[model samples]
Target: MSITAQLRDSVRLPGGDALVNGFAFESRGDGPRRALLESGHELEVHDLVEVFAGERAPTAVFPLPWPGWGRGVHSVSPDGSFAVFSGQRAVRAVSVGGETLWEYRHGCWGPEIGHAHTGDEQEVCRGLEHGSCRVSDDGRLVWAHVVVEPEDQDWQECWVVLDARDGRELARLPLDSAASGSHHLSHPDGIHMGLCIGMGQDGILLHWARWDGAKLTSWDLNETMDRILTDVHTGLPGFLTVEHYGADLRLHALDGAVLAEEAPEPADDEDPPCWDYGCGFVDADTVIASTVESDEDPDRARHWLLDARTLEIRGAVAYPTGPVDSCVRPLGDGTWLTYDDTSETLNRWIEAAS
Candidate 1:
């Protein structure tokens, strides 16, 4: 079935440099609502209800440790009270009021191994290799991937769960892999969080962990596949992952068994198609994905809808408003987001009613 995109509302970003990937529930006032990644190192909270009503001002803004170039990843708490940044040498949590609530410093992400001393803060801002963090559903725990010092080892990258109320370390697990960067995907059940570590040409590493108040339990993909874990949802029995180079999309069983696979089947005379690294379930039954990077001509970039369980290509998404400028970020509520880099505007979309 062919699906068309209908615009419900949009807002121009304050900095003209951000996008709304997902949302958070406010602890008060029907919850603060939407979230905007205001550049890689900065995060801004806003009310989607207000943005839909034509107000675009951020309700709260947070300044992160590293600049955008460092490519660190972060996570915002569910209550919108604070955010934790996985910086080059630390995981720091900052309040909505722009105050540093806590910071847990660890081994540097710099290339200079065997160096016991860390350089200036400026050096931390410039490091390229990085890690990621995520706040638990209750906002009481933080899971992070960072370089840590061990008694018998020089330094190693590991995933650790921390006390969200303080910076105290709780439990840790060795990663045994080098990271160019990583991110956490909160599971729909809110109990488990998925970690995706991108190691450039060395391939990708995927992990899942849960902190159950008593101990930390975790597992990994065992380097079984060169896949980028894209989306996880309660509605699906498993999760979705696209191949590292956008070759094919796969839906996997919870135990990592492939349930279905979808690959580009271009017309014989057309160019080979490729999917972007981003793809997610727009709703329980529908998956939205894009081919922006595969298009040599930007104007021809396309988005497609798929059967979430089967990975069957429904068809390319038709945007009546014209070509969408950015890849779609599925909201999992039958809607998604796309930004216009040229205009600095973010748009929310839904399927057009027949």
Candidate 2:
């Protein structure tokens, strides 16, 4: 099956240095949509959200905390009222007016800070770096991986849930892994979340959790497979998409069961086609997957559409433009968004009318 996407609209990013990979979108009202953009280099970081509506200039611009280069964990609330920034030493909640609502400090990113350090705050750690955090779907809680120090023992790392409205610690769960850092994947249910941790060659760790009002429950699939989660299929309740070690795309249940799997069609004399870690469902029945730039030919990349239930290749997907990055984000509707780093523009793509 062949899939064609029409370019709905393109919004040029504010700063020429916008980090395409760091962009995130949160919808508000019916008029225009807002998205978070991170820019700047090294220690100088500027994070802001730009409202995109037709051809008019941005109606509003909201600033967020500057997340340093290495620690890039941050999220805007769905309602676009607040922003949360998670770094090596702290997680803070800031209001749209730039007020620091509250902050929670934790262990440092490493045993010692790198030369990139510029803040006056002093912190220390046991070499655990690359921490991450995400806001819950309801925008009421923040799930974060942080270091917890005990009075009689050395520091340890754990997952902590905080009240997003005031940054109050609500719950904590100790984690056992070799994860230097991790990323949080939010579920549409507002009660479940997934954490993916990369531990060098040891393999990846998958932590699935459910948060009730009273407690937090979780299960981890420890180094079972070298897979990176691409999309959580909320439509199917327990199903999600994963790129297995960059080799094949697999549909997996929340309990680590492989439901279905498939790889891209390989060319005659060329190398086997691999899927990029960035992929997701365009709807209940259609999945959008992309190819990574080949190491042998860095400029080569392509997109593939697949049957969500059968894992069959429906067809190759073509965009109006020449090439795009591997970061394909689903907008919950049938439409999706892709970023062009070269042009510093965010393009919305929707299936052409039948």
Candidate 3:
């Protein structure tokens, strides 16, 4: 499908070097809501009250002086009234109008480099070297993966499931023998899995495990790393990885049996890997995958379209404004609600007929 840029708006931020971290399209409000990371490592909330006429201004700029520096919000409540923020050594909630509702911090042996500020002092968790955290859908469970030193100062992977209401550890999962490092993906459907990817003994071994409400179902794929890389997609039944051998790359459906695979023209070069975080289900057979394109060496940048079920090449377009994070969602009148973070604008686009 050919996607053309329809509308674009550039808003002047208060501080220099302002990077947008999180954004939400408010349904009830007049315009969209955006959160930006300022130069001082602070977060600012800008409420675009009027969007139709192109006039935009922040309704309120909430300065979150957590601790080390401000990263941004990971999740926002459905109503847009509450948000969960993670930065440095602090993770807490803030009101929509700029008020610190609650915050949690830790004090451990470390420099005050990447710590979040609570109220007066900074805090860091014990052995949590450099990692991130995320809250569950209901905002009741908090999950974080950290790198810690155990017996010989080697980095071991560990997870902590905590009560969101009081910040108490409820469950812990440590994988010292199963896998080394950590990589995971989770959804609201109770699907949680972790992967350790690297050049291993069995020539790129892919170890994966799923949380099935009661027990964890684990599997392994001993193939060339490129094949696993090319077959990666989130829309399918399990952890899908594209395997690229010399002549072709087959999309492995991971836990699910192979649904479809692609082997494009040999001379055209491999069609690139699937990298979109969210996949828009176009139909039972097709999906709309977001891509970030570039002007110089467009193929090198992370951008392209693919068949949802088959992972085949379906034409690619490079936006004029270079590479940007974008999402395409079905909106009713044959148009999709699209947002571009690099341009700091939101607009609509229609998909071309197949």
Instruction: Quote model 3's TM-score.
Output: 0.55
Ranking by lDDT: 1, 2, 3
Return the TM-score for each candidate structure. 0.89, 0.82, 0.55
The residue-by-residue lDDT of candidate 3 on 1-354, one tens digit each, is: 434443333444333122211222211111233333343433444443243345444444445555553332244443445555654345566666667776655322233456544554544333323333555544565555443456775445455555666656566566443221223334324444434432233233355454433454565554334333321323345334433222233444455355655442222454543433333333333444443321234344433345666768675534555544544542212333445454545554444433
Superposed by TM-score, candidate 2 places the C-alpha of residue 80 at a distance from the truth, in angstroms, of: 2.2
Clashes of 3: 15
TM-score ranking from best candidate downward: 1, 2, 3
**Stretches of candidate 2 above 4 Å error?**
14-20, 23-34, 40-52, 55-70, 113-119, 122-128, 295-300, 320-327
Per-residue C-alpha lDDT of model 1 across residues 1-354, encoded as one tens digit per residue: 457889987878644333433223221212333555555556766766677787757666788665633456667777677888877778899997778898898887765644544456645433578787888877898989999888898779998899999889999898878888887877767678788889999889988778888988888886578889888765776789999999999998766789999996574766888888778888889998998878777777888998888888888888987776477777677787787877878788998987
lDDT string for model 2 (1-354, tens) is: 657888876677654222324434433212123455544321112222232354434332445454233454676676656677776678877776777788998766564534444564533333546677787777788988887777875677888999987888999888775566677777665677878777777677778888788988888766566677556654765555565457778888778788888888787888887776667777778888777554355356677888887789988777666655446766546767676666767676888876
Give the C-alpha lDDT of model 1: 0.76
Judge candidate 1 at residue 102 and give its lDDT: 88
Q: Which pairs, if any, clash in model 2? A: none
For each of the candidates, the C-alpha root-mean-square deviation to the true structure, in angstroms, is: 3.3, 4.4, 7.8
